[model samples]
Target: MSEQNKTWCPNIEFNETDEELILKAELPGVKIEDLIINAQTRFVSISGICNPDKSTDEKEVIPSQFNYGQIKCNTPLPVAIQPEKTRAEFIDGVLTISMPKLRVASAVNF
Candidate 1:
């Protein structure tokens, strides 16, 4: 496939729980080394490369539906999170990211 044909962005899902925020991204055929994950206080971003199939011939391809090449997904959090405590894991073509919600300190009246 050509460079223009090989570029696509993956789809991501974001959810929030009582204690943490969760992210799930579809990243089939992507390797851990090719992935980059970035976390901030209120946002998280992920980029990765999905290698194209080398065994298939250009003529043999009928309908192309797969997403290949560099892919990126970014989303802003609904609430502030602790970026330092963020964690990510990739399993079975899915990437899962978990970030702990920041604890708000209450002011005490004198």
Candidate 2:
């Protein structure tokens, strides 16, 4: 944890208009294939491995803020979500996920 980014909380947001729950994670220099997404009946989990020294595969001789280890976060879903109806993309160093919220029907009489 750095002095500047010591107050960062990675979580998902529910966009009512979009009718989907979006999850945003700040993972600098994370590869697409290194990330893993798993969705269950009422929850979703995302995790990725970060290797700051992967490009060279050389021995690391120093430690710094850039050194980020495995990151994984499991978020509880508000509504049932289709496991197959999920999309993820990586841009720069952030990961964006869009999940379509499941719809539950209710019977009402007028």
Candidate 3:
């Protein structure tokens, strides 16, 4: 888990449906307000920082091992997507993004 802490959370999954691609990102302890979602073409990126712990605010003296800051990371998707049609939702610190795939015309030889 420490190695994962060095970067963003490692837990993620991708699912493809007839009309859309589903992406789920795990972000524990992160507030919904802090998250930012941006999508373009086939790539989507989300970055955000977890809110500071409430206990820290009451302390008169600072701790030596406490680490708090704006934690942000970006990840790329495997396929192209329509950014404007994309939708996102967050629940229990997990972010789920849905992107509709672009349509392509194919030719058939008779």
Candidate 4:
């Protein structure tokens, strides 16, 4: 399939702490160099490819369980964030992203 033709959505998990929002995505067999992340103040986008296993001998395939293809995940931030300081890490077939929550300014009346 062409690079632009094959696409899929990977599953994701979200967590929030007092300081930041954490996003974890399941991406088995995907390389770090193949990933592209785009973060905004209220949104984040992750895209990559999970290439099919070529090492396994081509037998009469009965059934395939793993979803292998172009994977993409787009998630909305619970609160505004400083996208410039966002951090992403890929380890053990999982992608974790931490986004610092923007602090709200308080108002005072005399």
lDDT of each: 0.84, 0.68, 0.71, 0.85
In candidate 4, residue 14 scores what lDDT? 88
* Backbone atom clashes (below 3 Å) for every candidate: 0, 0, 3, 0
Would you list the clashing residue pairs of candidate 1? none
lDDT score for candidate 3 against the true structure = 0.71
Model 2 lDDT per residue over 50-103, tens place: 655455666647646553566667888777776788888889877777878777
Q: Which ten residues in a row have the lowest lDDT in candidate 2?
A: 2-11
Per-residue CA lDDT of model 4 for 19-90, tens digit only, reads 999999988878899999999999999987777666676763665567777777788887998899999999
lDDT, model 2, position 52: 53
Q: What is the C-alpha lDDT profile of model 1 across 2-99, one tens digit per residue? A: 64346566788888889999998889888888999999998898877877666655563465577776776678888899999999999999999999
Instruction: Name the regions of candidate 2 deviating beyond 4 angstroms.
Output: 1-18, 54-63, 108-110
Q: How accurate is candidate 2 locally (lDDT)?
A: 0.68
Q: Name the TM-score of candidate 1.
A: 0.85
**Candidate 4 overall Cα lDDT vs. reference?**
0.85
Clashing pairs in 3: 41-81, 42-80, 42-81
Across residues 1-110, which tens digit of lDDT does each residue of candidate 3 receive?
33224334326789999889898887776777877888888577776665455685586365424323445555676777888999999998678899999777799899
